[model samples]
Target: MAPATISTPRYLLDQAKRKLTPTPNTIPGMGAVDKRLQEKEWDQFVFAEPPAGSDLKPIMGDSGVPIIGHMIEIFRRGPDYILERYRREGPVYYAESPALSSVLALGPDATQAVFSNRNKDYSQRAWDPVIGPFFEGGLMLLDFEEHMFHRRIMQEAFTRTRLAGYVPHVDSVATKVLANDWVANDPRFLFFPSIKELTLDIASEVFMGHPAGTDKELVTTVNHAFTTTTRAGNAIVRKPVPPLKWWRGIQARKTLENYFLSRIDEKRRSESTDMFSVLCHSADEDGQTFTDAQIVSHMIFLMMAAHDTSTSTMTTMAYHLAANPEWQDRLREESERIGDGPLDIDSLDKLENYDLVINESLRMMTPLPFNFRQAIRDTDLLGYFIPAGTNVVTWPSINHRLPELWTDPEKFDPERFAEPRSEHKKHRYAFAPFGGGAHKCIGMVFGQLEIKTVMHRLLRQYRLELPRPGYQPRYDYGGMPVPIDGMPIVLRPLR
Candidate 1:
């Protein structure tokens, strides 16, 4: 498909690129400023008077409560609050958020404009207000040319051959971790925490190639770091006050930086198949490799994104299987038909039912419910004038549950994604769990492989059941969607 015709944010893009292109000694300190000030600057830029004879539609919505805006409501109600407004207003709705008054673009058309970003009018730095505080200098936070430049160098690590090689490692980690660590016989098992740990261990072993059962303390710290960062991204107290989430997140980032930076010299000299090794060595034709700081920065962001999204997805999938035993039985039957445990890339493709279930689960409980961007220039999104610096958000989480898009939007139905009827394909951005366009997730394939491998082992060994019938997981939208109750499930050995 042809990429959208996008325009670069010339001055700002240059400034961002310079920030990321750090000097050898000064690398650690670059891009460390809290973005609250940047957000205020954007408010001024966005809400300023338009040029003469501007025919743009003035943004409309509740200004929200005083200084805090509508964020409290958004935090309390999650995407439902936004969806309720989208229904009342239209696809192009507006609201005053903590960052500023912005537009919420619903449905496929808005998603395409934002995701396709043909005009290069949107800035990925929109994540800066939240994610940048914890994940600055990461590729996801970079915009346009700078993003593409780093992405090109990083692409060498994720080639088809390299990904194929990683599968065995993923399978190995999944098997060892699940079999050894998850033997709880209690009728009520802590599914979220258990799955989180398992996925983190897998991330550690597969992505970093850490020795099995080694570095327990380091892993624990890393796990804590990820949680702290997630909480920081959604923290109500956005300032770095002591004893607050922001302060905790800073400490965690410091811990993570020291660890990753310390390993750079070692990883660069050594040769291995792990992602760290690949990143350490991989470079572009110009021989441009990620600097030590860049490697550590990217690792912190990517690893957190990798493990947390998977945990949320697996938790939701388990909930669905627990609630609907028929689907669970079908999944078990599908596993049996495929012949045995520890599925690889070749055999995994044959597990059609497994794919169906994963798809439906993602649809029912989308991992990344929403994505945001800031307009870098005056742009028109589906006939609505979005001024420069306006915080524009697209709601894929709620979009997946739109009545117009799905036959029974709220119901769990795997067949919707199967056979001649591929519901997600109905719209280009209809089921964008991993996002769409140029900045779509780079680890998309690797995540799927990891999920399948983990599920393959899990289905062979355990018959999963919720502790109680008719149980529904309550998701906390603080970060990604996670079960607030820890998603209790009972696992009985199928063997």
Candidate 2:
């Protein structure tokens, strides 16, 4: 079969060229390339056909009968279904739905090769059809040099000094959001929505430099857009008909673009110190910067990353802490040691127990279970030959739960991360909550600081427990692993 033709939007092509030119003070060993071949290669490689006899795996049930794998079932059953397949069929496996040509990788070495060593080979295009309209020039969709260049420009927004400056902003947002009366003593309060609200507030204050609780409309619009786009990407039917999720996603993208563009001029004129301002004033080696559209698209991507991933991480941590009260007590005791005060950069760093809790939560409930990469060229992974056009996946969710790497693989134990054990050191990619290598999450430190700060304040102010005994969090296997129902918790004032 002939490969699918994907035309680059004129604006994205222009932005790519702008990033190619060298800028002042380009790092000595940056290894910058000023060419379009990489991007061209990506377009060709993503849509190429897989070799004959590369049969996709079938869904197996308890009785061992082959069942049709649907997106709905995958979203509902999540890692369980995939893990079951891995147990039955070795390391590499495949699954197919009408919409996706899916691949699943099950061990540390396999995951490392896909996410770390061979990331350049994968295409973000699978996510692009939905996210591209909203985040046209965002780094996630760009490959190789194009990805590096934009990442360099955005790195200015996350400097240590800038992150330190965000401390008060994060603290203030957490205090205001967690102090709500609705959260008090309510055992059935849905956590996903609540945490989503909190993260949106944090993003406004810390990323955009807006005041907490403001920009509600813009936040709602972008959040809806992200949800709709993600759903469309995983939808089994790929029709362009109106009223479908894909249609709604496209409309949402336009709404976000318009909203972001309207705010750019005001933000630029004020010369604000937030990420939006940094992107506006940032220049490459040639003193070039993103145009208006690029700025809006980038903001959309940054806002989604900042809000959704942080909120999901916080929710997962809450689930595990609520499930095990003894651990919660330990964390609260640690918080008491640090005192019940607003966390600054220095104080946030001191919460070692909280850090372990967060790490364990991430291991069990990885926000992105599998990282996908297309092979840029033919490559070898653990003696298996992977052709240039094939899709490669790294399963962090599966690897994190391996019996060989973790003791009591399914239990909620934070001490495994403490000194002397440090079991995650078994392999380089054994604990990649934020991935590894060149495309490792640049905001990893910032994300960790944000979650730790929130958990510290919550522990000091409230005693939380799960609504019902033996509550198990269900997974949504769409993009990130989100709790199917909002994680419910009852909060009691600590005082």
Candidate 3:
């Protein structure tokens, strides 16, 4: 499917041409506005001027096509579409699609401005339209004081002591899943789906404290529900009707709620190692604890976040390692030094080479690429005037590959994250795979440990390579950027 022709209606072309006629004002460091911005209609966002008295420049750019906007091009070209626009329109500009219509904020500067949210102008309500129906009560959906309240309670479960406890369970679950499901010497092993299932199993055991293989059918149902609900974020028709993607998502949300609600009472009554029990028994400084409803809501969101991002990260890392066998061998040697045994938190930390590989992979893909926020009050981003009630999106994946930020941004170089180079340190928000500021991912440490442990086991047991001489993964940007082909690879037994 081709992107809608930008040249149409003589009037639009004329107006676009007029806007390009070298205006007096230009963004600092940007000099004159590029003629590229005039390629699309500026009036689509209805920004006739900046607010009454504000000196901020009127937000500029066009809505692609008519109804669907840039949705087709976005799914077709992925991050490249946004990166091209960023170059043409500069940092702050308008973007529209079936899923969302907002100002696209590119680069670390924009990332810091919104995420820092000093004025409290940005609210999490922007996500209500996208993920609110399904993950309504999830932590990311909450804002300001309410968000902080819930986060304070949630913090108890992710403390260093608690994270250390989870490592053994993650390692054990990964070892068992790899032993049973993966066939050594298999020429066409499906890495994406296989890792997805493995991560889901890990979440079940480590998060819900479910024993391996217990309630097998129910776990499978929950897995399907998560996949459906997450995919619904990109549904063209956002309403629930019949068997459409949006409707399926609504049903899946109900399924997830039911699953979590049914298990809450049991978790609350017992003291256990899993996060569910931890949240149930945990209390804030004032001895406050989550109510049953709060526990259920948090669990559903946490469960989805935990497994989904981990699955994506591990899959991307596996693909990169398979493609670059030298890095895989180098990592294997690092893991071999630790040898075969239960990997503790300290041991996991010792794999410095693995750390660089993981950081580089996250920079390349970043499971959660876009963050959404609505302007509660009028706000200015990099001199662009954004009125109240506008949805603002920050694309971190674009910032990751900005040429100014990293050397040879397109190439895969793990060493950039290592010693003398340390490119990721160029900016505070430069390498935010887990996001930044208050709403950053709560389960980040747990997620990283989970990935490292699983990859360590896989490296010990198998040598990874692509099924063909030159295989590149085609990702479906519709959701969390998954490999559409399931990422097949050859799994050669090492020991």
Candidate 4:
């Protein structure tokens, strides 16, 4: 059976909402969202301009299967499926999913177009299907001026002073996690779950200034909420089907809202150094502040993006280093040269070799595999016409591995990023692990600091090793690409 499609998008979207609408017990204090969902109608927009001229081509590609579309095939084949197709189909091509037909903008050329979305052709709104319900009003979901306005105020939360404050929390937490949480030399210590836990703990501490296990289990609830919401990023079924990922995501959204809203008053009253308090007090020069909605939404997205990417990055660095001990030795040697002391902004930069390895790991794994945008108006990706409302998929994930751009694209080579051998500089958008243009990750600095802080502690203290030296990560690329088995590995103690 095909996944349900909406001919009347507004009406069908409403019906889908009704199916997933929260129950009182399931959603807690989300009666407001329920009210909005029940009463509000989608203000559908259509352009005044006529269709593209006969000269320009329609989007090139394939919409696989009926109903289910490319959903199943994507899961089976992973991103390489699209990569191979891109090689055969050129930089611009079309592909269909259960929800919408989209233009696949591969390689650096089309990728630069979408990321440098100048005329407001692409939108973050298309993500509403995947992330809207969970992270509504999130910075990533807003478009045009509204996105800029919110980003401006939210910028206060990630300022240099704020980031400096966050480093101590990052360093302290990394120490505590390695000491209390990780058992060194465990033959089967899983890297994915362990790193996930560490990053979540780091997220709770560094972002919210809250304890991971304490606060009456605040962190635990937050952890559950992040897991449920992220797991539903591409759930096949949209309905609140019993025992399902989509359903849990809805419930998690409600919990997150309640918890975040409850903290607003307290955060405003006190002067805390955490990002949460910073956001609560954050305002533009015109005295504009995030409504309660924007604060919570931004926090939820920032927390998850930070947690997920940092975890993926650390795990990849660990996996790759374990596989290549010489590279591991090279990095550890630099870490030692920089001293086994706490790293500040200057010291973090001084660990040039460490940065290269981290950069290479990000390139190889490409944490946020694909960044999505929908066309708001007809747009051209390298002369290929993408009609309005088509979901535009751009791949940094696939771009990193393109043979035309990177030398020996599949080899685990960190020196490609080092000194004169800077292969990532071969193309402007060729190595966009953190995305590009105005929509580039706001937390890139913080994410880098967090990754370096954790790895610095671990790398110096241990000679890490994976149980299966040649074990390849089988990525489950739903939202972010994560290893299905949680990346099993064991740590080898240096002392």
Candidate 5:
């Protein structure tokens, strides 16, 4: 049975026939958006045309409909919307959505242009309005010198030794939690939420140094806090109005702040191997440690990034393996070759098939789909004039699927990542699921180790298949790309 086929939604196919007349009050609290200006064009959202006397081409495209712009199309249509635009326009184009009017940079060269940012023309400040309120002062939101300063300090926590130390804890958590929380031979196990819970538990142990039993009530609250704060990034109404996503996230941020602040002293005083304790003790070359606020912010961001991203990636891996059973069997055989024992970093490296599958899974459905930045000064991307203050969007999701860069780009063949067909090596930024340049994900190594450990345990324990033959799940990209159906699977024990 084949994975479900991709189809463009009817609305998009029929958009040409629809009336262009604006609808009044389609989205609540959109008074701030320039509805009239939105009628001009998406490129015109920033400017009617390129700056006078600049030879660079003007970004092309309309902002979609007024106020909400392309928000509905983006979330509802998933990557299809972006792919359609990529096909219509070249690498550089314009798009508009609530709170974001920007140029979409596609392909490896465009991604490198923005990420390399040689002249320091781009700033991470663009993330401020999106995730900064909740993840404030976290490493991703810092810019230039300050970013280098904190990244250097934070490097202490993710050192090779620290990562190796964290692996045993990850293995143990995966072994215990999967065995304890999951029931094998079940025909309807919800893979997404189930793995979400499992990864959260893993994070609690490996990142916080707390066993699964550590303050269950507090841990649960913290977990929910991380979730809400992340989901708040997509809130249509950006204000902290009661009962809305933004307000709940603001409240969740407070919950996280108090929880971390209360325990910072203990973490600093203790000799613990968890990330929280490590960050407390990690210092830059000059021996400057993070202040209490910096520690709290970093901890919140790391915890959220660790669990949520791993959950998405692991779920995607499970889906691909389930959909393509041959790959599952191959990976299982590779895992089985390792024999039964406590897995370590060296053992993790031996699973070549797993690495290929993981890379392909990441290419197929990257957990963090978009890399965002703000142009701090006028710049040209591939000769397209991008003015200062323009919000810039680049899609790793799009990059991974560019037909020019990838062979049969949409297919599930993981071998493209293996051997002589090393398609990801096509360009420097050709396959950046972890992002690139100075701000590449610091915990990427740890993240991959955690995923492999949990996944290796599962592959060793059971055969994963979709709930029914040819069953395919639809993804909701509201926050990260997650299966809207929770991705139910039937697990048959290998024994």
Candidate 6:
């Protein structure tokens, strides 16, 4: 499975190159762009026109080895290597992908510019050509007016009343899933696979109103399709060349879509309280309801978004809790305080300690380390000109570790987030586990409730410990992070 080639048309590349080479022209806000006088500032903007005769340091250490750079190290090493290089080589760093050029940006100012104010300049279109087969017409890939319009319809699924309604569903689903027949004494039982299954079940029951035992095959198909599509998106060549991963991904997506479309007619006819039903009955301001195709596409998108992200966060929290007994003890104590009452929305609010632990886990091991946005126009970012069509990545993994914002940044300290300390308050985007701005994750509240509920039940019944001391989970770089060897833990029943 070769890495996916990210291609930019020659005309677009040429346009970006032109924008990079700024000329001495009078611009309103930026004053006159004097080429000779502002050469230093100009050099910051242009990668091709670096200060004459200066050697470009490798964007990532030893990642230049064939296939290893794109295929392996980037995912395996996580964000530390990139952040280390950024610190050594200044804010904006460049790397070659064999397919296309990539630029990685770090620091609070750069992150804010990319994610907050200048998001319009970036396109999720690059992701579209690959992910489109699976998540077609999803809000993450939509742009401009279409994005906003669809977002409004999707927003209806996450209202306060709707979220409150989901609390019990989350509680019940978590309770049932964690109470599976798996042995409590076994340390080799993989938490990632278990949690993945649990989240998919949760999505089926909570989001789609499917009964606990129903839709097993459909859920399995969707999960396989999502995993395959994400892998295909990262492939260097995506043709259905026999036996290749991309071919399998394409087949998986087709199968999943067929299943979803098949169910849409039935779902549309039977009015219900699920989010899927809401989406089916939902109409835009123009009285437009999603077509069958749109319905299937959006349903797949919602399920993938809901399941994978929550699973990742929960897995990370589990790993951290297993590693730090003190934190686990604190969480258990907090869960005890909340008692064994139903973990409804009101009960979730009382588990403030659970919130801190989850927030801290997200900050330490962010599910999506970097967000990609393509520049739409020539934009000045803190004096650096980011040309249109340039790929701009805001590394949240790096920002989460910034020393200026966090005390003992590398340590797992949930207390730092508690009151009186209030460290994360220093920067609004400091803890962007759910992201920020209008594009923030819509299911964030639901995700938190799900984690707290699951944790509350699990902690009350069992004392979880890792297989070995100082065990760190390895991530599968294909899509969202997953435990490479399955996070092994022993769940000792509380006596």
Best by TM-score: 3
List the global CA lDDT of all models.
0.75, 0.69, 0.82, 0.76, 0.82, 0.70
Two-way lDDT contest, 4 vs 5, winner: 5
> TM-score, each model?
0.87, 0.83, 0.91, 0.88, 0.90, 0.85
Quote model 4's TM-score.
0.88
* Tens digits of per-residue lDDT for model 4, 1-495: 111222323212212121122122321233764344334332222212225464555443333443655554456445676786676668876565665556678888888889988787888866777777888877777778898998999888788877877887888888878877887878778889888988988888877788665565565787888888888877887777767888889999888888889888898888988888889888899999877777889988888788988998998999998999898888788888777666676677777777888888988888887877887766667876665666777888888998777889888888888768788888898799988877888889888888888888898777888786567777777777788888877887787
Candidate 2 achieves a global lDDT of 0.69
Error of 4 at 213 (Å): 3.0
Lowest summed lDDT over 10 consecutive residues: which window, candidate 6?
A: 11-20
lDDT of 5 by residue, 1-495 (tens): 111111113112223332233334433333555345234333332232466798887665455765777786567656766776677677887665666666789877888999999999988877877887899888898889999999999999888888889999999888988777787777778999999888888888887888875768555898888889999988999898999999999999999999989999999999999999999999988889999999999999998888888898899899889999999999988988897799889899898888899899899988998988888877888998776777788887888888888999878999999889999898988899898899999989888999899999998888888888888788777778878889898888888
Q: lDDT (0-100) at residue 20 of candidate 4? A: 20
Model 1, 1-495: lDDT tens per residue? 111222222212122111111112211222432222222221211222234587665443444444766565466557776777677667876565554346788888888889999878998867877777789888788888889988998887778878778778778877887788885557668889998888888788767879656878557888898888877888767688999887889888988898889888888888988888888998888898888889999899888888988888888888888788899888788778766544567777777787888888888877788887888878877766676766788888777878777888888889989767888888887788888888899987777777777887787888888887677777667778778788888888876
Q: How does residue 493 of candidate 2 score in lDDT?
A: 87
Q: Per-residue alpha-carbon lDDT of model 6 for 1-495, expressed as tens digits?
A: 112233423213222222222223321233332233223222122342223353432222111333433333455456765666567656776554543355676777777766775446666654544466557677776766777788887788888888888878877887877777446889788888888788887888877798665877756666777777666766666567867876777787788688778778777887777888888888878887888877777887788888888888888888888888898998888788788777778877888888888988898878877776666665555555455556666777777888889998999899999999888887877777776666678788888888887888889988889887777776666557678898887888996
lDDT of 3 by residue, 369-466 (tens): 88998888767898887767778899888989988999999899999999899999999888888888899999988888888999999999988888
In angstroms, the error of model 5 at 16 is 16
Model 2: residues with Cα > 4 Å off, grouped in runs: 1-73, 118-120, 129-134
- The weakest ten consecutive residues by lDDT in model 2 span 37-46
Best by lDDT: 3
TM-score of 5: 0.90
Native-to-model Cα distance after best TM-score fit, residue 360 in candidate 3, in Å = 0.4
Q: Cα RMSD (Å) between model 4 and the true structure?
A: 10.1
For lDDT, candidate 5 versus 6, the one ahead is 5
The model with the greater lDDT, 4 or 6, is 4
Ranking by lDDT: 3, 5, 4, 1, 6, 2
* lDDT computed for candidate 3: 0.82
Q: Model 3, which residues run further than 4 Å from truth?
A: 1-48
